[model samples]
Target: MACLLAVAAGYWVLGRGTPRPTGTWAMGALLGSFAVAFASYAPLVADGLEAIVPHVARLLSNCASLAAATSVLAISFQLNLDPVEARRRIRLRLALFAASAIGMTLLFAYEYMTHRSEQVFALYLLLFVSYLGFAVVDFLLQAVRQSRTTRRSSVRLGLRMAALGCVFALVYVAYKLTHVVSAGLNLHLVPEHSQCTSLVAVPCVFSVTCPALAVLLICLGLTLPAVVYPLSQARRRRWEVASFDALGPLWRDLSNAVPEIVLSPVDSDRGSSADADFMLQRRVIEISDGILALTPYRCRTVQRTAQSLTAADTEEAAAAVEATVVKAALAASKAGQFADEVAPPSAEAASRKDLRGETEWLLLVAAAYARVGDTGQLETVGA
Candidate 1:
């Protein structure tokens, strides 16, 4: 499941030019190798039908390992070398893997190889593991080195996770090498767990389980950067959209009350289109402008009623007070008292450092202002 998910995310990253590095495809290759291995495994294949032609699966797996190893090398080292040298090295490695895979396939298809225990199979296994293992270790060193120079937090985190994954891969290498030695040299490092299969066995757990964990860790490392970052960005965009929605009613009401106060006057034929941030900033400005224009119309009755409620100075409490004052002022404006005056009830301009704080204060005021016509009094919010 993880390998499949990593494949999706890694491919998406590759398509978008994300992470700005070859590592994205490398991550996909790591996941792809696991996916191919799983696909080839009899248990995972369609009803285990591949059990009849198991050698074919082995050939595919061999190629996958080589591809994964080359990808790992490409990602681990920075692309700072000469282009011609890089191309030559890549082509040479690819040819090597292709030749090995073809030769192995022919050997298996012919009847020279009967089972996985043969010397040739052991040799192939060792070579496959050695390439991937070397890449894993080299990747760890290069990633750690890059981490020191990497200034971005996300990138640093990705490199560290990848390094940790390499540690698991190295452990898998150790287990595999031990198995190869036991199989090819007829040497058993681990005692037969007190007993073995009537004929043969050595630490039954290491064969399949250990490598499974290594692949899982590698997939997880691949997923972090590819999946987490895009999700976080999506969440942020959603928040911006929600904020815009919450402020919609306030903007509409205020625009109706004092249409002239709007910063960019809308034309009848073509409406002004804007982005979330721009709309938010513009709405705030329009609301402030409307309040400024209605300053001289503050209702003394509303002020007295609000003062009787509370004197708290916290943000919420302050908003309540401000809401009542705006509500009263809106009423006074509608009733035509000082609605057309040039002077304000005060000389001070309200200012706050936080954008959210300002938005909250204005939203509370807008809500109360909306309610004033129906209630005919400042709603005793705090009281």
Candidate 2:
């Protein structure tokens, strides 16, 4: 109970940063239900609370599980997919889960009142196993679907966390099932034996431990972004500044070199066309250098893009130029340097493109360019 309260407090504090209404409400419901369930069992094992406590706890757990399930459904609804369809599915699932929870809660209450040993055990087993299976299946299916569709890194991280939660739930379910089967088998084999108490004790330990561990793990997973988001933003800002700083010296060098290259055209058409190409090349080189100076993370990507261009040009200058443009676009994508000024390849080639090797090369260059840009920015700021 104390551990759960601490987790709840932590979540509340973190929730202050971002208002995730449904998530917060769901967490609160789950914790509240857990507290009630613990209170119900703790008395039976330890200090021995009033007879009513255990019953109340059982009821609370059932209700809380229903509420938590609803919250998950709510999250799916708010995921910005097809809203009408999502809402419809969520409503249907929520209704079914609620009905199951209510029915189980009623059976639990009746069993407690009557003290019918076999029926009570059966009700508990069924409720626990069913909920565990349903939760795991639902969460994994949703996580897999989201992972395939979502482009956002943060969203993908969240989906991974959800998948982990499902796995944990599965482990808990399996542990419970093993205990249930062992106890049932023991009871069947020794109808008059009291040795079946050990089988019951095994399940008791699992019931207590699984919920506690699961709650902690799930809460931690859900709350991670609250801690990580700020750090990620800070890192991005630092990289941006460094990239700009690295570009300075390269830009100056290119500015000085370009006029000389233009004055003495290397080919017959070099005077007009070559000067433009030289300027463009200088800009690209400066950009690449800038990215290199900024962040070590993307340097290899930038280098690879540059290499692809060089190789293509070696084969056929015109073909190389065209390939370079395509490679640059792809490189920018791999580097995540989605600058508006960086044009994509022509639609015709981009659609039917067999540019695997070429694309990889460009991606490397773009990563390097982004790093240089960051380094340049840092230098400029520091200076």
Candidate 3:
């Protein structure tokens, strides 16, 4: 349960921008339920106590639960109630808290006066616990129904998980109700048996088993956003950044060689005013077109040199070789060396399926031009 709370806290920090009323209430419910469940079974760890500690834990748990139910009720109705209605709700919760505090005091007093063992559920179990169970179940069912009717895939999936979590919570509450009735009537649901036969059977229907199972479901439902949302956002950011980095060199050098290839004027301050994705695409297209336009000047010596350098069988190497070949061809065209023009040969594929690959290839092209084509070979390409 502490682990679950930690996860929710992390998620809250990350997702503060888009707060949902339902999600807030669900987090409260998880925490409240965890406290009560943990308190019920704390005896296994410790030997002796005033016995009042568990009662106190149970009381605080009930308070948290009642508050959670109210939140869920508001969430289900989608009612961002006006200030007047909101104040009324707050007053009612305050009244419940006062009553609960008084009730807990009385329980402690009874234990102090009589010095007898106190039943944990003696403090208004049926009234509060049953209401909490129904309220949460109602909210989950509403969410599930709404999700079924909704077209959004992510909402539908998340709601279904919430519904499953609530079902487990319902089972846990059912056990609590059974305990309440049995305790009130002075009867054990797990009836004691007296028999001469040596065989023995044990029944633990009123045990912590149900609540424990419910904890697993609730924690899972609450923590998924913490895991999934951040990773998806991170991936998108990386893709955009990679695209810009890989295409930078080619965009710069090629645009310098043939200014007309760049469709839009550069951003005076940013050096490019286009959106990252659009700019990257434009750069790729413009460079390809310029290379095609210069194809008639392809030199045999330069193509052979490029083929040898690109023999490493990698995209990066191929891109660098291609850059050198293009620079040599552009220089030759400027010198009027190819008196008769021939059609350009079929070019190799970019083979860049993702942003990373695209970025790497483009960056290699830019870096190679900067490294080996610094002789200003394309200075007279248009002359």
- Highest TM-score model number: 1
Model 3, 217-323: lDDT tens digits are 54554455555666766765566556566556656555666677877775631223235556666666777667666777766566565566554666556655666
TM-score of 3: 0.50
Off by over 4 Å in 2: 1-51, 152-158, 175-205, 252-383
Ranking by lDDT: 1, 3, 2
TM-score of each: 0.56, 0.54, 0.50
Counting clashing residue pairs in each candidate, in order, gives 0, 38, 1
Question: What tens digits encode model 1's per-residue C-alpha lDDT throughout 275-305?
Answer: 5556666677777787777677766555556
Candidate 3, run of 10 with poorest lDDT: 194-203
* Model 1 lDDT, full chain set: 0.60
Which candidate comes out best when scored by lDDT? 1
lDDT of each: 0.60, 0.50, 0.55
Question: Which parts of model 1 are misplaced by more than 4 Å?
Answer: 1-31, 43-63, 69-130, 137-167, 180-186, 190-205, 220-242, 256-258, 265-278, 288-314, 328-378
lDDT of 3 at 124: 59
